[model samples]
Structures are given as structure tokens and as C-alpha cells.
Target: MKLKSFLLICFSMFFVVSTVQAATTISISVNGTTVKTDVAPFIENGTTYVPLRSVEQIEGLSIKSWNNKTKTLIISDPSKSMTFRVNNQSQSDSPLIKNNRVMVPIRFIARNFSSDVAWNAYTKTVHVAKINDKEKANLKSEDITESRIAAINIPIISTLKELTAGESSAGYFQLMFPEGESKNFFTIQNGIINHYQVKENAAWLTWSGIIGGNKNTNTFWVTNTDISSEVGQRPTSKDRLFFYNISEHSGQSQHGYISTNGEKTILGSKDMNSLNDLYPIPEEELKH
Candidate 1:
């Protein structure tokens, strides 16, 4: 009886350990910048799973549609397309919807998009990097210079007003920084700010935080200060409107004022236009 009881205890411990490993939270980074997601990624049976919406942020990948009746999901890019069935019990690698978020295999999706995916066991993190074909060809040439590489990495600066001038008015705008290769895309809808970062030739949704408004004044404050590391710290008050400009709907320096905060304040600016534009976000992204 003593030996049997010891065996049972050992089995129970093994089961608990396995369960913990399966549910381990995983951090995802694209090109090096860590991305924030509404539903955290996790590992199960040695496969890392991320939110399906997160996959849409990757360059050259788009979620076309998902049919509930058939449980079929269609994802495509300019060059290739793929389909998957959700919660297919017969398929171990099938995508699953949990807590209203569609979770898909990261490796499978990454490979389909021609992006390199790496896993770090120590940190429990997944890194996805998009391969630039032009960069590879340029590297092989002897004419490549340090100055040219620097110029290639430089991000184009543009204001929201300019980018969305001809399009239908929405509470969305693209903001670019002149300081670094980081381009920030934002949508100020309702009272929330959905922030996205463009890096490694792909876009990642970095933050979705609340914006505080003052009823007495025309100014509003961004509640979350730690939005982007590349842009550095920004003041919460109206001291400087980093990417928003109220007067002309143009991009402003750190010394600009915030005249409009809610809905009407989707401001942006442009400088030294480059092809490395901000990745487009889905129209229904915030709706979910």
C-alpha cells in the first residue's frame, strides 16, 4: 500500500507539471520590439499559439474571412493564400477560438507568410522577422555603404491629415517620427487610443489605452505614457503634442499643443517620404 501511494503521488506531480508547461505564457516580438496583445500567446504540445488577429499584423498577410457555419478561415497575401479550419479535433495543429479570441499556430502562420520564426526557451518568447528580398540583394553588392544602410532604415514622417486626406473620414490616422525608423499608427475612436508600431517590415499592435479628456478645456491627456520606447517618453499634459496637431491637422513637434483630443484629433505629418509606410490596420480591428 505504501509503494502504491508513492507511485500515485509521482504520477499526479508529473501531470501537474505537464499542464503548467502547456499553459505557459509566451511573449512575442517582431524584429526585436515586443508586441502587446489582448490575448496572450501560449505554448501547447511544443507549438506556440498566438491570436489570429495578431497574424494579420504581419506584413503580406491578411485575414480574408472566417465562416462560422463551416469553421473555415481564409488568410492570404499578395503572393500566396492559405485556409484553415477552426477547432478541428482531427487536426492537432488546428486553430482554436478561446475567450472570443481566435488562437492560431504561430509557426505555421509565420512559415506561410515567408517570415522567420525563432523560439527562446529560457525567456519563453517567440520572435518573428520578415525577410527583405531587396535588402539581401543589396547586401551582396559591394557598393553598399554605411550611409546607404542608415538611409534605408530611416522611417518616413507623415501626418494623419495628409495620409487620409482623400479617404472617408474615420477616427484613424498614421503618425510618423522623424527621429527613428519607428512609425506609429493610431486610431482615436471613442475614448480609446489603439496604437501600432511598424518594424522589421511588419506592423504590430503595441498598445490600446484610454485617453483622458478635460471637460473644462479643449485639451486631452494620454493616460498611458509608455506607448513606445523609440519615441521616448511624452508628457501627459498639453505641454507637447507629439504626433497630433489641432490647428492645421499637421504633425507637430514635442512643443505642439493639443486643441482637440477626442474623435476629431486624428493628426499626423510627413517628411522625406519613403516606401516603408505604416502598415494598414483592419477597419474592424477595434470593434472586436
Candidate 2:
């Protein structure tokens, strides 16, 4: 009976592993009421997956896929609209199917619904909260330049720089690209900054340039700096520092360094990194 006993032990181990995977859940809400299901959402490589149809029906959002090669989910809400990868949270031009369930980035859903969403690591639950109409209107009315950095992903581990009044008058920030041939450019004129909004498959960040009072081209400058110099750069008479959020596509920089006539006098190095950092690479940007 030794063989029989060994078989029994192996079977028991398999059952235990299956039980753990099936234990994960997505707690959903309806009119302030929460509903928990015994059904376990699919999981792959640590990301919790949910059914697209189920999420759309309950959340009142419409999802449609146009390209046959790619499964796209579009939230037609006028207030906000964005597409997310079906399989990975990284940037994606298309979605994926895991165990027959359509996986997507939680942020895409949050942006569309004007809701704040976060993932609970221990519980593996995707939390979503809806924002009222009044809040939606207020956010829309805010100065676009004032809050442009809100939705963009910024690494939390970045350093902050301090700036002087002259520096603040002229917007001057530098961006670190992802080691590619891609180049970023912008212009500052008459206290106004104009630049392209850099975007990848799954995400995009702000790179808008600002103009100073004099409208001089020499007043705008950009550079890449080392983390060790972060502290030293912050105290300069015409320098500023800021820490960007982890989800930001590009890191943060201190801008608004201008002279009395709205001219750029100094261009310094400004970028820092943490020991352990996370940079989101949208998977969908690959197909495009």
C-alpha cells in the first residue's frame, strides 16, 4: 500500500494549490452596497483579472473592439475616455484574454468613470469608486496647465528641486526618455509653454513648454542630471524640485526659470532615481 499512500499525498498538494488561486475576488459595489462572489477572477503573473462584459454592465460603460488582431475596450463617456491592455497593466494598443476573461489596467476604468481606483496587494482586490457630476465639472474647469500633471504617471522615487522667482517666471523642465531614438522638443514664448503630450500604447505624459515675459528663445533650456546632484540643485537661486508619482510615464523636473526680461540664463542637470523603481511599459504599444 506504499504506492497508494504516495498518490494520495500528491493529489492533496494539487488540491491545495488550486484552492489558493481560486480564493482571489473582486469586491463590486452597487448603490453603496457591496457584492462578493465565490467565483475567483483569473490571475496571471500577479495581475488580478476580471470579465470585461461583467465590468461594463455593472459600471455602465460600453466596451468595443475595432481591430480584429486587437481586442479594444472603449469607454464612450464624454467626460473621460481611454483604452487599456486586456492582459497586462502596461501600455497596450490591444487587450488580451486570460483564461477566457478580458484583463485590463485598472487606471483606464478609473479615468473614464472619474473614479479613484487602487489595487490591494494583500487581498488582490480591484477597488473602484465613482465620482459625482459636480466633481467632474470642477476638474474640467480647472486650468489645464495647472493640473496637467494629475493623470500622467510620475515615478514616486524621483527627487524634488527648489527654484527662484526668476526661474518660476520661465517654465523650464527636462524629461528623461526611455533609451530610444525618440526625441522630445518644446518652445517657451511670452510666458506660455507649448509642447506635445508624449503618449505610448498604454500611457502618456505631459511635456508642454512655457513662455516667459520677454518671448526670447534663449530663455528656455533642458538637461539631464544625476541623482547625487539633486539636493545641490534645489537650493540654487533659480532652481526648483518636485517628486513625480509612480504611475507617471515620464519623471519630474523643475521649470519656470526666467530672467527679468524673460530670458533663460541657466540650464542645469535634474533627475533622480530610487533603489527599487517601477516603470510601466505598455504592452499594446507594440502592435502599433
Candidate 3:
């Protein structure tokens, strides 16, 4: 009986240590290549903690929540966003920041957007990898355009129309790049314009715009599906035209809205995809 009790205690202790004090970023390997970041990640306590961002960025993905009702965080590249539960729940109050460190939920922080997570207790580490090719392909082909990080000659009018239509009125234009490319999208807004989704690798001559007599000017990277950090200060003609940005990983995008009103409110969040079908991609644009 004593031996059995000892084993139970040991097992319990291991679980606690493996999932405590939130996720911290540490060195990790992506596709057999090692990368590093300052983002906190999941580790075996004493073992090095690998940052999920490093893996996600290296893997060309991002992370977001499955829904508001659940505590799961969905890591996704352009191709897909897989769900994972954080062992611990986060508080509504903003995260505590000590010194230069910003604290976040462990489980949420450990998972990257658009990747699969496997926790190995024996090895005392968490493994992140691209989901199976079948799943990845399916996710990529579902919506939007695949975005490769490349310099795109985006015309101001084209970007303005796409942005105002997609974002200003609680809408978004789905985008993607070719497979196996890393890029970001950026935009500049002036007056009344709230935000823009610019591909990281895309280069435009002018991003500043005038909306309702307000001048909004800002640059951003649009290469991640989840842009939670960019949502704030609703841009209006009266109040500074806040320049919120959007981005996504490279893969099959659902080709729909990911946020509304400067907040990262994706299409799936408000059941927009379920209610009304996504807008049809125009025949001219569907040539791809």
C-alpha cells in the first residue's frame, strides 16, 4: 500500500511541475531546425521552455481561441488552426507585467496558431509540428487566398476598397499566398479608416489615406490569422483613425472575415460563416 501511494504522489507531482507558472518561451526545433524567442512556452519546469511563437513563426502559423465559451487556443498557419486546451484558466483582468516580462495563460501561450501540439511527459517537453498534409491542405483550400511573403504591388485603390469593405463595415477579405512562402501585409489609413490587413512581404507605395477628414497613417504586418494584439482604439473621423492591422499564415484560408470593428473577431466567432455563406470570389479574381 505504501509503495502504491508513493507512485501516485510521484505521478501527481510530475503533472504539476510539467504545467506550472505559465508557459515561457525557450529554444526549440522546427522541422529539425532550432529557433529561439522571448515568448514564454510550455516546458518540463527544469527543462528549457521553447517559445510557441518561434515554432509558429518558423512553421508559418498563428494561434487563436476556438471560441469565447472555451479555454482552448487554436494554433493555425494559413492552412489550418488546430485546437488545444490550456491546463490552466486565465483571468479576465489584464495579464500581470513584471519588469519587462508580460505574463499570459500557460496553455494559450504554449500553443501556436496553425500547428499540432503533443505533450511528452517522459521527455519532459512539448512537441509542435505541422498537422498531417491532408488536414493542412484541407484547411488551406477552404477559404481565402494563400499569402507568400513577397513584395506585392498593391494599388492604393485596390487596398482601400478591400479594406473598407472587409473591415470598416465588420467585414474582411480572405487572402492567402502560395504554399511554402512566408510574407506579411501592411497598410496605411487616414481618417475614418480603422485598420488594414497588409501582407508582411507585400510592399505598397502609399498606405496613408484620408477618411472623413481624418488622416490615418500606420504600417502593419498581415501574415497571421489571429491579430488580437492589434485591436483597440476604434479609428473614427473624430477620434484618431486607429490603424489596426490584420495578417495570416500561408496556406488554405477559409476566405472570410477574421475580425470586425478593430477587434480580432473572426468570421467563425459570430457564426457569420454558418449564417450567410462566404462571399463568392469574383470570377476575375478566382483565376488562381
**Highest lDDT among the candidates is held by which one?**
1
lDDT of each: 0.46, 0.33, 0.30
Stretches off by above 4 angstroms in model 2 are 1-26, 29-32, 35-39, 57-60, 64-69, 84-94, 121-123, 134-288
Clashes of 2: 40
Tens-place lDDT digits, model 3, residues 91-150 = 422122323343333333334343333343323334344434443443334343332111
TM-score of each: 0.42, 0.31, 0.23
User: Ten consecutive residues with minimal summed lDDT in candidate 1?
Assistant: 156-165
Error of 2 at 58 (Å): 6.5
Pairs clashing within candidate 1: 157-270, 157-271, 158-269, 158-270, 159-268, 159-269, 159-270, 160-268
In candidate 3, which residue ranges exceed 4 Å CA deviation?
1-27, 38-55, 62-76, 79-98, 103-114, 131-288
On lDDT, the stronger of 2 and 3 is: 2
Error of 1 at 109 (Å): 0.9
lDDT of 1 by residue, 16-65 (tens): 33443465577776655456788888776777888888876666678999
Model 1 residue 203 distance off true place after TM-score fit, in angstroms: 18
